[model samples]
Target: MTENLKVEVVGLNRVKGKHLVAQIRLSNTGTEKHLSWAGEMADRTRPLGEIKWASGIGVLDAQARTWLLPYKPAGSPCLCSDRERDGLGQFINPGQSINVYAVLPAPSGNPATAIVVTPLAPPMLNVPISDEAPAGDFPDPDAEPVTLVNRRLILPAEALDKSEETADDGKDLQVNLSSDVLFAVGKADLTASANSIMARTARLIDASASTTVTVAGHADSSGNDAINEPLSLRRAQAVERALSALLTRSEISFQTQGYGSRRPLYSNDSDEGKRRNRRVTVTFAKPAPATREPVATTPPSVTGLTGTSKAEGQPIAMEIAGLRRLPGGLGLLTYEITNQGSAEARFAELHHAQDWEAYKYQAASNVRVTDVAAGRQYLPGRLEVPTDDGVDSYCACTDVSGIRINTEKFAPSQTREFFNLIALPETPGTLKVKIGPFRELDVPVQ
Candidate 1:
């Protein structure tokens, strides 16, 4: 064993996407001797069995026998199956020293303390990065820059299939639940109806035995920020507590955050819109294992909408979802409308482009409808001229009389469904589909 060979951690940093970086230095105490050291880094705050090797190279010194190394840290219960573990492989010549550096993902608020630097012969001297000085003072112009091999391990949302299966790999998996299942009217507390839904979520974590879980709560724009922010957080924490109780595994970790109206699933102008915006989502990640290769899978689906309404005396709103591509070159766009205030909402006027003041509609254009229920789909008898370029395109409805269509008494929770055939413009870019006065759905027509 080389008595002069000493290992020290000099710097550490936490990065976005839950990654950690550490810089280390190895030095020789003897005046004329060489040494070599190698080991793995572990975080005690995380699951004990979930540690992996980091990216980057090992450093060595030929004279004064010193070295510096850098390494990335990994979370626990790695999901990637394709990673490899290579122990230290080098020898230090007399009077030489070296340094090493690394980067990895770790739990928030918890620092890593399981770094074991072995000299192969006892007298191991591995010091934390905080206790050491900066290595920048010693410049080595001729030293070759260490190249980092950037590799990512992605875990699919469906990977948590077994009860005892824990995701210790440093891979990320995200799943979003429908807003309809997350909240009740004007309330932040979890509804009794949502207990089963939360139970399923708890099972997901328990099955995966994840090292960490982050739950983010969000609300619609129906209320002011002051009332919504804390409400969102409380909702998130509620879910967190539910999951914690269901998952009895003490090794599992958790975190909670609230975004309030900052992130909305839908606009808050209508009751249905507000219902779709209140939601809580949980994201889980596991520490990666050494000597494992990551598997490949398709990306998850994302859904959202953008809305705009015409300047008609009454408010107009539209909500659309399940926006997916069709077999032919044509795309499918579906939406629902609602009349909240006490007023008759005539679809016929909407068909003639009277509600919209921005875009001009050509007279006598053939706007065909493929499907419509009795009395629900009505057309305004008169045709209106297009006023500007921003007005939403209009389609002909069968009914012409401006009668009260869907809502009888202008109740607060009235809803109507409408379908339109949109011949996508020849141009490329995002197509903004206006639903009503307060809601619009933006679909990308690539």
Candidate 2:
């Protein structure tokens, strides 16, 4: 029964100007298949598929008197029971819930009176927010349960002030992806496998859309500008070409620039530094301001809690610090491991890699948080391939041959750092991080 499901607005924000980021939740109430609500025409009759994804969703801002549909950019990677499309739907499992993010126009008005969530597409699943639940009307509880389908959520007025404020993550979206992953040495052609990743990146860009798309290319100082400059421009143009095809739905103006060994992010003195410098940054323009308004409320502060942990006789010291927020509702924590012992140690083994399925497991799993008051433990959020919450430095940078590429050695006095990104809690409290099978540290939230 689609009606048995409840919708909750977990997070709302006006980012990149004129854009709204809403994190919503859908909960299923019934345990049996009779009330199951699948989001598809074919599966609507079958209770087994549960909630088929690509279920259309729309948002209505009651105060501003406008409606917003789910934003899906073409060629974007989508996944809900494996059916993800750019600007399409996703799935929701039974008992458990899933979070869906949609970008829309920021609703106008102080204390938006109410916001409504409507499940579009399948008419049977549509829950129109009208009045209270009908008396003794359960809709058989097994058929297309249409009771309590529409969720009329009230919006906050104070947080919706009509004053100009900068977005929390900033106005523009910049992604600096390593060129090595997209091209071969000194070439502008994309690898065969890179196309899929580029498509996914396109969708991410569409998520934070803009009227202008700029692809800036950089190169290591291996060659002179006379040669490197053109190479860099070609690379940027290649990216522009791919993006142009993927963002056909958008009317974005495309531009490309080549730095040609200039403006290096890292000193191109070593191979690793060169790898870091040879990169392309895709910048998307923020929307033009519709009107000066309080874009959003101050987000919860993200700070690092410095502490140390060690395993007996391992001579390994971990300085877990450098905590910060990620794009979504995720936070990242870093652990710096220093080998104080007389011999070298493999960094992978120290991280309990044996139980980690050979670096295939998401690095965040090594971390679990506990709310001191509730005594409930929370796991990491959903992540894509190379599961480890590992930063690029820690995450596998395998070549086309599928070989593990990393620098995971910690010699005496040498230090290596690992990062874990996990879903964060609202009104953050004192959180204890369970790291590996060896150590635990408490982080008090402010």
Candidate 3:
């Protein structure tokens, strides 16, 4: 194991015929920033378990078994890493440990013999370019980068189906519960359906390999931050209480936080948007297994669970997630709007792929801009939803309105997020952004 990065391979379990789950721990020994994909977009990093023989170099073992994919397929058990929040890889802080939940495929071989790991080289740091070149622009060509060694393992022949004492991997899992099921408007008390929602959520939490659980509450922008923040936190605590009572495992850690009117799933302008905005996001981080340990027991729910698909609907909502006037002359508006309604809503044209913004009622029509003094109206900016991660989701769109959904149908209870980069028209002073007939926000200029 290199001092820079140490990988501990605790155990290997066969999920099925040719697929396997590798439990690994990656630790940072040096002070230099170790790269993973946590803060980065999904497109930046390659999937963990995928191996391409055509490339000639990837993770392979003497047993002839190879890992081929990074995602947990339909039949695979719901691992905490599988349910983790967005971002690939991660950047581990010094003295930090990150668990990785990886899926791999094998043709046929005994992986119990020896497990080897070949991690991609760390990302190169960017050096600023001057008129000519920076002093350190060129690195020593003869320099040899450090190599990451794998943790060796030996599992019994029948270790495929049984639960091991050690659950390896250090990735966080995320599951969102509809706030509509938890509370009513202007209230923080748990609704009757709150029990049902928690029941489902607790099951998902209890079933995983994660030891730490964080419940974060969010509310619609209906109210100001003052009222929304505490209410949001209170809602989260309510959830924490339920989990404390229901989940009997003392080893599993639990905590809560509240972001009032902060992170909305949908626009707060419409009822549906507001409904979806009020939500609780539960995050679970998989516990890295101790070497030679086998999972003694799993939650009772793990065996009875079916399946959960988190990618579904979207709605253009009223609440603004972010609003910034860019340096050049344009403005960037980030917002969340999801279909909390019982049905799907169309805000764009599927046939008009090139004309993504074409709609009978353009969200641009619903947009309004006012000067700092509130005395003038400026030219409205066209809406363009941010597209860092493209549509692999059930329903999808980047449009702020008429977000054409249905690939997953704006199922009665689903939410998606979007941002708009609008032409700000070089407005001076503060600007009031009004979307639809409802939401009005103030953006100050420097």
Candidate 4:
């Protein structure tokens, strides 16, 4: 139960055998007052009837590590409950149970289940997908379902540092090495550490089924193409030569290209983003799938540790419940916060953490998941949203506003829960979850 409301995820069904539709039943059990859907559930960034619709609703594809948002056809509104069009108004009356729905892009690869994500409630995990049509008219009956190309990140089990990382979209795998670590500034010659990076990359290639490897180089937005394009190509050539020497398979071939800031993984607005944009990437086909057990479901019980947060100058207790692997390729980190004192407590320390600084909104975006055995840390999952100007990235985690807690003045003895979505490792193991100002908890990825 979240904020005196009970939520039931009915099912995710296929519409026209192309689009995926999700139906959720929301019941208002709180006797105090009516609930505002927009204030609590809608994604604040949306344009129309934001408060009246669940436009921010998302479906988490665990296997692809992607968040599928409500899809809308060109020049049309989001395929969700219309503003004031449905019988329910901006608010849900007390003791009233209503059903809200959203149309999302059907996930590729035909996943068996998806994690339903709403603002205030605990994630509806492993909700089975059905072939039956939903009970009402489609949100946009005339519009056709178009497949949108989504960007996927390869969550690595082991990492050397922030300078080198890898991400995959379940199909192709990419190993991204920062140019600063691979070469001298403005030069294409391999640096001292390049050999070790290439050796590690060679091992990954040796295990892959692909015989042709593509090495691509990218530059930051600092210089023009004349200076960047040739330099990037040279960098790719250098990486190709090193890989050819280190790789054991003699028949494997290499293809190289230079993209001079034409493609970027992150926005170039900040220094960190710019540094990440300047990179050399090796792309190849992932190895064939092996027979493995189905993705595990989270346990129904709650068990965790509680600690105080003195950094916020308030008597608040932070509890890290546990980390459990969910069906599909993700993990759910459950936690809660309690205000112990009479005065209201604000989570300033948590909102200002380094990991969440980029996201100014009030959410549990600061949490980090560390694979204990692999010695690698991961942030919350990210999804790219197409905007008018370009694409924007957001953390695929819980937004605290959906939970019934005052952002500034958390009442005395008030406790609020949070659910964060994170990408899981290829193999199940123990995980270390770091919540705000709380000691890290050792949680098994069961």
Top model number, TM-score: 4
Each candidate: how many clashes?
81, 12, 40, 5
- lDDT values of the candidates? 0.40, 0.47, 0.43, 0.70
Candidate 4: Cα lDDT at 344: 65
* CA displacement after TM-score superposition, residue 394 of candidate 4 (Å): 0.8
TM-scores of all predicted structures: 0.29, 0.35, 0.32, 0.82
Lowest-scoring 10 consecutive residues by lDDT in candidate 2?
156-165
- Residues 1-446, model 1: lDDT tens digits: 22356556556444443333455555665664434333223211123243332222222211111122232223312211112332333444555555554543332233333222222121112223232333343222123333222221111111111111111113443555444455675566776766766786676566564788888887777778998888888888878887888885678777888898887544466665565456676777422222324323432232545343532345555555433322111233444555544565443334443221111232211122111111111111111222354222222211112111222222333554443322232233344444324433445542
Give the C-alpha miss distance for residue 148 in model 2, angstroms.
50
Error of model 3, residue 130, in angstroms: 41
What's the best-to-worst order under TM-score?
4, 2, 3, 1
Candidate 4: 10-residue stretch with minimal lDDT: 149-158
Residues forming the 10-long window of minimal summed lDDT in candidate 1: 159-168
> How do the residues 1-446 of candidate 3 rate in per-residue lDDT, one tens digit apiece?
12355555543445434444444455777787764433121111223232211111113332221212233334322221431442324466688876554434432343333222323221111111112221222221123232221221111110111110111112443555666667787677888867755775576567667678888888877768998888888888888888778874678877788998877644577775665567777877532222333333431221211112222243333455545543223344444334455566543321222121233222323344555442334323321122365211111113222222232234454443443333343334456666543445675432
All candidates in order of lDDT, best leading: 4, 2, 3, 1
Q: lDDT of model 1 at residue 303?
A: 53
Candidate 2, residues 116-180, lDDT tens digits: the string is 33331111111232222222211122222221111122111000111101111224545566687
* Candidate achieving the largest lDDT: 4
Q: Give the alpha carbon lDDT tens digit for every residue of 36-149 in model 4.
A: 655466654455345566766667666666666677666445677754777677666789877888888776667667677776666777778887877777665345764453
